[model samples]
Target: MTDFVQSARHTTEALRDLFEATPLQRNDHLSARYGAEIWLKREDLTPVRSYKLRGAFNAMRKMRAARPDLGHFVCASAGNHAQGMAYACRHFGVRGTIFMPVTTPQQKIDKTRTFGGAAIEIVLTGDYFDQTLAASQAYCRDQGAHFLSPFDDPDVIEGQASVAVEVLDQLGRAPDLVILPVGGGGLASGVTRYLRAAAPGTAFRFVEPAGGASLRAALEAGAPVTLPRINSFVDGAAVARLGTHTFDALKWADPAQVLLAPEDRICITMLEMLNVEGIVLEPAGALSVDVLPVLADEIRGKTVVCVTSGGNFDFERLPEVKERAQRYSGLKKYFILRMPQRPGALREFLNMLGPQDDITRFEYLKKSARNFGSVLIGIETKQAGQFALLAERMNEAGFAYRDITGDEALAEFLI
Candidate 1:
């Protein structure tokens, strides 16, 4: 075996001291839906509820071994990475300073603190991850502490390769295809590299959030390039740019092999996994599975493994998740209607609704107008085609309405 692959195997064995191998379970629900033997590498079941712990633990262990005097480590993260680092710090009996964005969810912040306990200090700084990252790097330099990157380091990448080692050991053979969620590319790069050597015949598919497709961008540009803007809804994998080290490892990945899962569409996968399979997945965690439908033809009758990257979902976002899912699936819509100022006009609008159509939200943008008033309305229906029928009825009734469900600017402000 190559040195890296051998190191990865050793790392996987060493990790047994921390936690047993995460399950690689065949998901019947997904298998039936896709006509493929679908297995989920349940990284969500890790001690820190993420595969991130594997990389963090391996990196920290190697670092401490090289420099015993390195007593402190630092990292900047808004979610899973922070918790992973905290868990690793506590395990290694080394102090760690974690810098997180001020706007990070309380659940994540609390989890990081809980994982670190007395072994780490939390610093809430800046508003965005970039700002927090800058602060953390500066602090590391001043304190002469090692600043651990979440995915950009060789040791971290090698550590992440342990996931592939475990997968092969548990599955007893190579899967026909392995689907990986890509962020800064640590897990994807590591897993792909190891599997390429260990399971040379296995194919690979890379999934990235559409709003932050750093890997796709890199493949297109032939180098890592920063995105002009990134949507952070899929917080764990919403990277603006691919890591240099990670890109170097993944540079040969085919552009066609990378799939971009829309952020809103991921909500549908999250809800399905939660309601049907009783599995809760954060947005990034659902990426690989969410892209399965796109690869249905390619994977049919084959054994495919989708990495369930993390499960640190906060129940508070359930409503938003459902809303986004509905919107993306065309089961829900928002519209602005201009109504005549006449008694029973509201009743007329209500009568236009089909039996399956339900009004989820109704508001008056302008309740009092000389001749007409503007009404902001949200409708949920059992079928997507219901919207077309509703629009036709509104036109026949002489009602002027504008569908705002697909209007990004208006939806951002009003929806």
Candidate 2:
């Protein structure tokens, strides 16, 4: 075995003392839909409801053993990593300090505290993640404590390789393709390294949130480069830059193998998994599965494994997810209409609605002028093509209207 694979096996073996391996269950629903043997590596079912705990446990154990006097640990994270570190602190009975962005949700902070109990101190600082990370590192340096990186450390990468080890053992053979979700690239790097050494024939496809395509950018640049701006819709995997260590390990991957998933399109996958299969996945965790349709031809009749990375979704975001899915699928739209001030003008406009079209929202934006009034309307239809017909009817009737459904900037301000 290669050195990295050997080390990964050792880490996997050692991790058993903390928790049982996450399940690699064959998904009948997905298999039937795609004509493939589809398996979901349920990292969502882990103790922390994420695979992050594996890396935290493995790294802490190794660090404590090597430096017997190490008594404290520090880390900065907005979600999963914070919970993992908290659980590890409680498990090892060591003191830990966790730094989180001020904008992090209260639910995540509460859960982290619950997992860590009295073993951890939570520090809420900084408006953004970079600020929080820098603060955590400085605190660690000043206090002589070890700062635990979420994915940039070699030990953490080795620990994440355990996911691949479990998959190979549970399946009894290498999968034809392993679909991995990439953020800072710890899990992707580790899994690829281990699998490349142990089963060179296996293939890999890396998925990233389109709004935060850090890995794709790095591969294109031939090195890691911070994106000037990033959308935080997929909060779990919305990293601006790929980690240096992770990129080093994954530098050889084919640029074409990296796929970027639209953040709004991922909402469709999240809703499908929740409604049809009774499975809930956060946007980041659903990345691999979201790209399945794009790879339908290549994966037909092949054994495919998708790593469902995390399930830290809050029910409060359900409405937003549904709205995004509707917008992406063209089932919903918003338009501003100029209505004539004639006696039967309202009736004439109402008559333009097709049988399947339903008005979800209607409001008069302006009525000061007697000649015409502006109306803000939101319509939902059973079919996406209905919008084209509706537009044609509006044009033929000489009803002035502007569709603002796909206008991001305008929608943000008005919709």
Candidate 3:
């Protein structure tokens, strides 16, 4: 057997010391929808509700095994990684200090504390991730504690390879295509490395958040580069720069195989999975599944596996997710209307509404002109076609209106 294959197998066996293998289940809804055999590696079902624990556990285990006296570990994360490290620290009976961004949600902070219990100390540092990371590393260096990199270490990479080992064993055969969500590329690098050695024929597609396409950027630049700006909506997978170690492993990947998922579109997929399949996936977790429709033609009749990376979704974001999904699917709209300042004119505008269109929000703004008033309106409809009909009716009535639904600036300020 190849060295990588043997190493990954050994790691997989060792993981049983921490927790059982996460389930790989055939997804009926997705399989039927795409006309392909679709399986989900349910990493969300892991103890910390993410595949992150795999690498954390493996890294901690090997560190302790090699240096029996090493009793302190440190890491910086605002979400899943923190929980993973905390859980691993407790498992290893070691002291760990986790630094987190001050802006991290209370829900995530609570979850991390619960996972680590007394074994891990939670430190709230800077407002940004970079600052938190720097603080953690500095603390580790000064205190002589081992710093656990979230994705950029060789040990973490090897630990992540255990996922591929379990996948091959669980599926009985290598899938034709494997869809992976990319952040710093740790999971993708590790899984691809092991799979390439074990099942040379399997193909791969890498998905990243559109606002944070670090892998695509690195591939194009022939090296890792930091993005000037990144949208952190897909926090788990929205890394601004690919890690050096991870980029080295993933450098050979074809740029075309890297797909970008828009943050809004991901919300639609999250809602679909939650409502249809009863699967609760965070923005990053739903990425692999979100891209299935984009690859419907390519994946049809092929055995495909999508790694649902994490399920650490905060339920408080449900309303925002639903709103974004509605807007993306054209079920919701916002518009600015020039309405006449008269009672009968308001009645006339109300008459133009189609049967399926319902007014969700309406506000008449004070105007200097006595004859006209500006109105902000939010409408919900059963179908996108209803909007065209409503627009036509408004035009016939000589009502001046502009659809602000897709105007990001206006929508952000007004909605």
Best-performing candidate as measured by TM-score: 1
lDDT of 2 at 217: 93
TM-score (C-alpha) between model 3 and the true structure: 0.97
Residue 145 lDDT in model 1? Answer: 98
lDDT of 3 at 171: 98
All candidates: TM-score: 0.99, 0.98, 0.97
- TM-score for predicted model 2 compared with the true structure: 0.98
What does candidate 1's lDDT look like per residue over 207-310, in tens digits? 99999999999999999999999988898899999999999999989999999999899999999999999998999999999999899899999999999999
Name the regions of candidate 1 deviating beyond 4 angstroms: none
lDDT of 2 at 269: 98
- Give the residue spans of candidate 3 off by over 4 A: none
Q: Report the backbone clash tally of model 3.
A: 0
Scored by lDDT, model 2 comes in at 0.94
Per-candidate Cα RMSD to the true structure, in Å, reads 0.8, 1.2, 1.3
